[model samples]
Target: MTDRTPPAPSLAQLRALIAVADAGGFGEAAAEYGVSQSSLSEAVAKLEALAGRPLLRRTPGGTVPTEAGARVLTHARAAVQAAADALLAAQEENGGLSGTLRVASMRSAATHLLPPALAAFRARHPRVTVALLDSDAGGGGAPAVRSGRADLAVILADEAPDLRLSPLPPDEYLFVAPAARGTHPVTLAELGAAPLILPPHLDSCYRRIRTYLAARGVSLTAVSEVEQDSVILSMVGHGLGVTVMPRLALLPLPPGLVALPLPEPLARPLALAALPHRAGLPVIRAFTQAVLSHLPVPELPAKEPGPLPVPVSAPPLN
Candidate 1:
């Protein structure tokens, strides 16, 4: 009797599966990938046949990966990324860099820090495309890199383990109050005098501030908890209450508010995060160099170890 074994699935099939999962439907995935819906459907069908299991299920909302498909999807992303890295390595000497580099970043970093770095990168490698994924919540970027959805992420230092980190400049947390209410170098007692306008309880920044203040034997009453930085700033402008926010988040401070350094300064530690295995890839290295070159680094006091902030899961890819 002859032995019969199915051949391994092709790269095309794996990519098709990934696209479908990402887009949440065959038609949308095909449109985004610039391929015919029938072709994508065919590729996924063949992939499922080889695995001898259903990979996707259709619902009223859209298509989603099955239990088995979710397991396979993880490996599929890794396999695709490995192949892309190999190709990038081979082409490094032949011509300019070309490919998409996905980066996940917090809102403030994206708004204030990434523009110049991205400009520098584009100047050198115009052929490369940069895709930004929003990861506003603290520690959110780490999961994007782990899932292979983003090649690099700007995340809080020590946010996740088992990944490579390249430190960026620390952003100082300042005491923001109505200009009429304070002077520079506000004391802890003065900070606690007014109701504090803070980010929501679940925000990583909020947790960091709370931890730092608790260590100093201080606790302030909160007047309101808000999610949007702009809204928080607006409220402060109207003298609703004072807030403590990272300097990066207070950029272009409105006219009516004053951001004073606290008597004992607090800063948010930040770093670039990438998968340990993929950190050295040529494209990632180039972007990392661009960022490091463009962002200014200042002398900062050594960071003291503190309680770890809770890790928030990245939202599912759409």
Candidate 2:
């Protein structure tokens, strides 16, 4: 003899059970779902057959769930709510913008660049939540977006094809030194001659400062490598050494540090990256719009031949 397996309950069956409990009768439940009373009854009957137990009782107090029906309806209500939430998420992708977004970013950019953009984003989309995750330039982000740990990442425009990239402002490299050194618009060759503090050569930038120097017949001398941009900026501010890094990295430079734009700017394109399909979602669109609307690509200023104003709002490391 061949074995026959029962089919699992469909969404229709589950909805019928929950509606019947709420509306208290097959006719009322059918009206709620815009279906015929007979169809609703049949759907509940299928649920009972699948569970191998009766799920409803006729009582003077309209229609009531039997003990078994009460238990099954509890699960049915939960499943229904989950379905509604799933649909709501899909709707949000279209135009229903109210959900939390998990965002990923590298340490330097997160500390210096993202704050203003995020604050602007919050001002615009007060209902949306953006959770930022700090990552090493080369790691932490890939696994995050791939494993559903993050919805978006701000990374270099051309770094990863899998992460669909949308352009933000490209960040230009700057020569950073102690203010007491009295910035006189130092050239790359002059910067190379100073005691240098720097981060390890990284992937998004590929040792940006060094690569540019290599191209210009310059080389590091009396150099010290620190692993964090914030630390490097701090070291440079303290007059230990001078360093070259993205202008965005030394933003709001500490009390004693100063930035000089390179004569020939060395820069890396930064962009919003996400699983290709996620780029168009409403929350992501909102974030990207906020970024574009606020942070314009900084046009390199004329070389400041003297000490400029120190930004009082700079973060504490320096």
Candidate 3:
């Protein structure tokens, strides 16, 4: 008697299945996979054979996953996402110091801390393409880097892993209010009296602000919840309400706004984090070095924590 073992499904077969399911048909899926319809069908068939069952049902209206297919497809999607990340990492590794470098950060860090560093980094490695990601567009940089979608990420000290932090100067807290109200340091009691415009629960800065206040036995009564720090600043400028954010956020304060140091100075530790396993990649390694070199330049002269009419161009989101 002879025993024959079935072959495991290949990544290509798995991707073909995922593409077909996502695109909802063999024709579209084939286009997505850059293969002919017949070839895609063959790949899916091979995958289904390995599972010893039909993975998809081809109804006239469209292709839908079979009951078992749906369960397996969940795993397939994860596998595909993982494979895509691996492919990206492999490409970066193979490209030496001159391929795409994906970066994700909150708006302030992206606007203030990153611009000089990026300019200097580009000057040194002109061949590398820099891709910047914004936090609100998705969850944020930390999640992006964790999932391998980005080479580097800027994250708050609280949410970041202890091992990977390339710490930056702590970002100090500030009281921001409507431009009409004007800028001046406000006491916690005075701040509590107003209808506060607070950052949503999701923001790292929100947690920082909340934790700082919580330590002082104060809790915010939020009148409005805003997401983008820029929008929050804009709302303050419009006299919608008052809010608290980091000093770095004041770089591009809106036309009519007041930013003041809180009566009690509160700051959160900030860092540039990267996966230690990716240190061997030249692009990430070089960028980390370049940022470390460029992050600590002396601050330009600034007005004493009030609306000084500083301006900046709009930055792109990834």
**Using TM-score as the measure, which candidate wins?**
1
Better of 2 and 3 by lDDT: 3
In the range 152-226, model 2's lDDT, one tens digit per residue, is 787776557678777777877777787776667677678678898777655444366677778888876887878
Number of clashing pairs, model 3?
0
Worst 10 residues of 1 by lDDT: 305-314
lDDT of 1 by residue, 92-144 (tens): 72268898999999877887677778887887899999998898743489888
Q: Ranking by lDDT, best first?
A: 1, 3, 2
lDDT of each: 0.82, 0.72, 0.75
Q: Over the stretch 38-100, how does candidate 3's per-residue lDDT look in tens digits?
A: 988999999998899999998988999999998888777667655644655564533444667
> What's the TM-score of every candidate structure?
0.86, 0.63, 0.72
- Judged by whole-model lDDT over C-alpha atoms, candidate 2 comes out at 0.72
What would the C-alpha RMSD of candidate 3 be, to one decimal place?
Answer: 5.1
